[model samples]
Target: MSAVGANTSPAIGQVHVLADSEKELPVPKRQRLGIAVVSELDSLKASSATKRDRKRQSRKQKQLEKLPEPCSSDDVLWKDIVSVLGGEAIDAAIEDGKDVQAPLVLQEEVELEVKILGSNGDGIAVPVDSKQPWAVVVPLTLPGERVRARIYRHARLHSFGDLVEVVEPSSSLRDMSRVQCKYFGSCGGCQYQMLSYESQLEFKREVVVKAYQNYCTAILEENMPEILATAPSPLQYGYRTKLTPHFDGPSKSVRKGSRKPTTEQPDWLQIGFNRIGTRKVLDIEECPIATSVINAQIAPMRESIIQNSHTYNKGVSLLLRDSLDTSVDESVDRLSDAFNKHICVTEPKSTVREKIGEWVFEYNAGSFFQNNNSVLPPLTDYVRNAIFPPSSTAPSTLTHLVDTYCGAGLFAIVLSPHFEKVAGIELSQDSIRYATHNAKLNHISEDKISFRAGNAGEIFAVVQDFPRDNTAVLIDPPRKGCDEFFIKQLLEFGPKTVVYVSCNVHTQARDVARIVEEGRYRLESVKGFDLFPQTAHVESVAVLRRVD
Candidate 1:
């Protein structure tokens, strides 16, 4: 793994530690995230709890509007003023009649050394010379690089910039590393392609660690629970089990050089992944990250869709799912046929089967299945071992497993054997339907496992019959992470152990920190899974045990 600026110091001033914890290290100001309220806050006609939230947000905004405006004659630094009062308090000081903070104007081309990577994989560079209270975020640039950038617009805490040139490339960029895909720069499907496979693993691990440092106050690096090194996927590229490439209509493709009327050429049917930083779909011929079978069908499918282009009035996303076996070809054929039949239908007319270990899971083509199938075995196995250690049977106290947000019973079925009984709860009826079917398909007795659907708020209510001291709860929420309501419910349920699996580490850190802060559980361990190897995303699992 390449060390970004291994020998060099950060170009910015001294890092300022934020809180009272001795182990809490000073963080770069630019990387500090803040909450922003939307215009939707004006409409608070939803639930009473939502109205209370809106009122609190309104009060916070009003407070920010009350602070004195910065002036050149003032003795205090703008950052110092904001930092002293805290970001939210300062935001509340914004002028009441005006919007939040005034948008910052762009500065001319300037050379800045990239200090660190931001949440979205952008290189963060603080302009030590500028008077503005913002850092420049440049995409397609790496930390430790000196780059000339043109500032676009200043956001709440940082300015967005366009990279002009890498004045001094990072060691990683200067190395023999090369992005494998031809469309690496334009395709939004994958990032971190520029880094070697080993470097990518390290980068992802660092991302998770940094997230915890930023949000989780209870755990410090020295005394923190073990964060096991990321388990690398067996296959990096061509590991994705499914691909959904789409095109917007009026499908128009221009025939080169021929002055033929625009309508004569295929109705500009551009189908593929969205271009990086934009919703525009690039006509991708091949995607190196997608499975081999999915790649094989792209060209023919594009041709077939264009040939019958008249049938499609609106742009549509096509699902190409691989069954991941010797029958992959047949499976692709079936999906392609389904696409042809349901060309306009949003839902595909088929379900695809994926086998992990001895179990085969069949779900709809577009539904959620772990994208990186190669790493799922280890990922699930790790969760099982974390929840049920080898010595777990010694107590004979733990009796059941409760899976919240259980999608199609992946963990419930996998962990069922170790428990007396397992219950899977999901908000989606379709997911519950499939989860139940999956259990039956795997021949798990109905008495041993059951599935429930609708209103996750009641998830714990049904599982309350089981002794809290004998139950383990598995929560795998969506990317935005769990809501406070659910977290409160989980704490109330008071399971013996709570396992949280998240795709977004920042939010995971936030949720996990809150759970720990409740003084009911201690974080046991955290591990990252390279589920999406080439992307800036990591699936992390955090295990917390109830305080004895």
Candidate 2:
């Protein structure tokens, strides 16, 4: 062996490698499998590519999840605004890290400078934006003022917002004295105290016309009687006949460890109007809208309740009604005497007495009465004459009349002389009792005029046997309007005529639609009474005659 070869030789048990021409060196297993190495590299690349694809897909899905859901088509987006011109845009901001380009391409953002065109205790409307062209309604805004508003809710093309700030003021803003009460805005007793009386009438008239034309799809003829043409209340101030006060509680510890006050304090609860634009009752000691007598007794009543908290529940609502007959002061002697006679013998009466046509009604302080007392006679007369037109041929053969929802029997007692027989139906037991007492006070034959206590919707069932041809029905439904059952029964009973009195035009229109659809009655005459000044509330009467 050579010296270099011997030094390189493997020690002890190690093997030595040598190349020879005849014998080939053993090949390693890894070197012999070249395709396996290439396949393993390709497999690692494919797995990495799949993981990258999955991560990209997950990122896209997360972006898609951030989008807002679409709104319903019938959603009332701009109902808060009360404007005729409809052009407004939405104001919105893009989220951080969001692709602003996507929203910018699909949605438009606009800043609107608007003037409050009108208000109906619900919302204010501003002219639409020329750039955006969508109707917008703003809440908590008054008419005749300029405001900057940002739209929050969007619909098809329209948008709505809340009043941001008042830039310009209206000419009709109430002077300090004109507001009359300190709590004008807080108490919400009157919405139009800030507006002049004439302006109030104009606004109300516009509201009526707008509601009829816009919501009801009514075609009002120019020759039709104007709703605002009627006279307003003779006394705008102190016109309310009834007032109701709520009590919160007094400071007193009724029981040990209870959350009751420990010191004696004046009862903070009393009769008052609801908070402005809300249904909550405001704790008011006095209300300027109520009559003096009603205001005078409020503190005493509160004191009485507070002193006898154990006897009187803390949560009870107190009411004061006016029962005196003031009709004689107006030189309406016939009506005055009728009311005095009817109310004189009844239980203790309140302070206000109103005369409608030839009938006088003495109501409690908290009872409901037509606010526009001056126009009440004419309004009632119009209804009576339209329904029971004095028989030109024979006055004695006049048709019999039924007054449904006849609170205090004002219609029944006043129209008793014109009808051969009259009946009044009311749900309130107190109202029925008052109606009966009213007929007696007028010295009218109670036998000729009967009172029934039940639902007005079921009045026809009670009087279905009455002669249909010679009978007329007078309905003065609540603000919500008569139910479908009442309309159906009225049609089925088929009275000669129906005089519908309503405080809401939308419900009135719905009821009229039902009547016309039944094909039993035709619309004859429609009239409106501005009983509530400075507010959108209006009283309307529609006469429908049976088709022959």
Candidate 3:
């Protein structure tokens, strides 16, 4: 043999012993390895790649776990949703779609008669005049309408379809005359813009009804009161105080090196909500659902974003909040005219002000406050009146109110006058700070109202001494609703009454079902508030009384 070992092929997993390369010595070679491959012979440096991949995969898994989950999934549709839409009809339709005789190919077009509008505002349809096992969920359709739909996705129980044509229109439910937004079907921001406002409210009531039916135990439903009519917003089109317009960088599919983008493509920043059933954003010139001030600012905001597109690396939501600049005129008379002075605040950390009747609230624009300022007065009034109904307040022993998740003390401050003592607990230090400030701003004293910071478990522990028989708990949790640990703790505390306010009725129903289980509490009533009019979103309030 030559003076040195001379095998030429070297791969990531293969060990190589080498001498310095020279034409006379040996040829040096490196062979590519399969992706994510592992071998005992893999070099230390080569193993680093596998380690990186594992770590990156773990990070992605954690991120996915943190994402919000919808009420329905591919495996099973919610029973109440199925019942409300088309129970046996849907089942039959699904079977027909999967039938060997009439196979549902991808992008297959079929005329379907929509049976009912789903809680999400999509139309549920079955084959026209066919006793078949197949159903197609189509958007921009109404009940009793014959619509031409193209099957795009076939799920386990049902299929999803794109609305191609309305073969026969619904005279009652389909009211396109009232549509405010051009992006009604395309944008995910709204679902009921085409329907009458009254119809939207009615649909919301149906949502609550179905939510309870699907999410709650029969015992809870038996105790549940007639779900009150969904309260409507005063300004349906221009009520939203906050609008987050999102924009993304250019699509990766565009060939960057091939052509000048200015000549071939649209501007890079595609700003708006996600297109319905898609992750892509649509460019929007005006959002009619947002407040007047935000709409007026949209032109300038879009221009600024376009001008600084180079600064953004990925998609981001730009907050455009409608807030009153009370500082411009601090006079008592000016407070009443605050709405006329609405200004659009773009910065998230910037403080914003809104007045609900006589009470004023100031919080960071980034904070989670009610989006519709018009609905707060009636909503708060309903809650305050709900805690101790007029007939029960005088003889009631409930003198203490515990406001959980009390961001900026919205409910606590609003109900403080009715209670002898009130305490607000929040997880965010910033929210707690705002709550304390808001109490002072609203002229509530420390002895009457207080704010605490920590998790729900910690807050309940600190308030353990409060008499369960004399206190009422008001919980306004995030859309995901309360966790099991928190619910268990809440049951242990056993307050006299519990009022739950949630933006997500589905999750609220699930949580309240647990609270009212085992005959421990009676669900007094459930009501819905149209906090987001012209959209499918509804805020639900469920009142519970101890019965154990």
Candidate 4:
């Protein structure tokens, strides 16, 4: 299935309106949503992206890019839009089981007012002139904004387009003053930078609402709560602790001890990210969303890459992670002091330290950890309060917690004090090893806290001995969410409370629908967290309490 949108609509390019791959199992539906978006993916803890799952998703992505799957009856989002916009036109266009002519041509230019925004932040519009039901997916657009986009790829019911111009912008949502990036329309790094920060939060909340509306059809509409207001990031800009600036030096593979005879290096290398709707790398000197330490490192790093361009083959991303001075334990308590003493680490294996509230986390610079450090305190607080509410005696109420997909044991270690016992389940032994070491580093006792690596599908088998009624399971899976097998096991294991945190709400809704399918549990609350403030991405947490 060609992912019809970007991961969160901020990084939009190569997006397909319809996905064709129902053949691949384990690759969840929402995994099929953001195809070909640069893999600068966030590693939200309690995440489900094990090595095997990522490879499967990577392989599936290749297959999707090779073939565009036509929209089927079950592709509800596409079908609903087509029915709403192009009912008669679709019937007219279809002849002998295929459209006689595509509503828009390749490279055809058209100015269209966006009727509404898709869940992924693309503006969806129907051809008003032709009264055509065919839809166009345009990035960097908002509803009620008339924009000119060039049609690039056509699917069965809709066409994928590149935003060419915004002729008439929405009065309310469009505020040119808020757009800080000079490459607003062209760069794939951001989408909602044009809108006010307040608007961006609301828009992301709306995304959560739309995802549930589209994917959670199995659950009765009246039963679900309105998505809570999106929590704003403490700092909107210069909050990103990590940045990966990349460039293509030379295509010749770098082999050990190979003579560097003649791979001619290009005079200029675009040392940055992908351009909007294309794989071409765009040169970015500074990122407003990145921290001061990371921004300063870019120049020196780019200089090094350029200087050593002749020695390299293939494109490479230079990692710039901000590490705090952890030498003094007291400095970690003061956020400003900790941030003032920050170090930039370029190597993947180098240690990156982050202070989340009072707890400090240490992880490999290359591996996945939450990029936004500012909002983590609130994010973790929300997770903690969900089980042990501010009004209630939490630790006394819930004695045990099982943090599944607990990468580097962020949740387990953070929430350890509140629980009588905490078990962190992960597929990577290395992560578990890190978790074990982190517990000791944080002065958490091994008797009260534990970390183990287990297969995702059968993770509960490792924690089968935990008292179900006294336990809560904390899951923050990847964009795809939990597979059917894992969901089945979850319902069977039947913990007292289930707290699911997700980066992609579409799959979260899909997974939530399954969890509540048998009426064993009821969704109590759903809240959106603005981990990445300037972008379209929203980290959502859904709390489910057992009813039956």
Cα lDDT for residue 221, candidate 1: 40
TM-score rank, highest first?
A: 3, 4, 1, 2
Candidate with the larger lDDT of 1 and 3: 3
Ten-residue region with minimum lDDT total, candidate 4:
65-74
- Candidate with better TM-score, 1 vs 4: 4
How much is the lDDT of residue 402 in candidate 2? 84
lDDT of each candidate versus the true structure:
0.71, 0.59, 0.78, 0.78
What is the C-alpha lDDT profile of model 4 across 457-484, one tens digit per residue? 6889989879999999999887768888
Q: What is the TM-score of each candidate against the true structure?
A: 0.73, 0.64, 0.81, 0.80
Candidate 3's residue-wise lDDT over 1-548, tens digit each? 11112234445467766545554764444433532222323444557888999999677546432423544432124352356446765556445543222346678898988887777778877777665455677888888899998888764345678888899998887778888788877888888887888899998998898788777865543566888999888889888889888877665653243433132224566888888777888888898888889999998887776666555566788899998884665445644555347788999999998788778788999988998888999999998778889776368888999999999889999899998999898889999998898888888899999998856556697677689999999999987789888888889889999999998888888898788776799888899999998787789999989985
RMSD of 4: 17.5
Superposition TM-score, candidate 1 onto the true structure:
0.73
- RMSD in order of candidates: 19.2, 15.3, 8.9, 17.5
Better of 1 and 4 by lDDT: 4
Error of 4 at 399 (Å): 0.9
Number of colliding residue pairs in each model: 15, 19, 9, 5
TM match of model 2 to true structure: 0.64
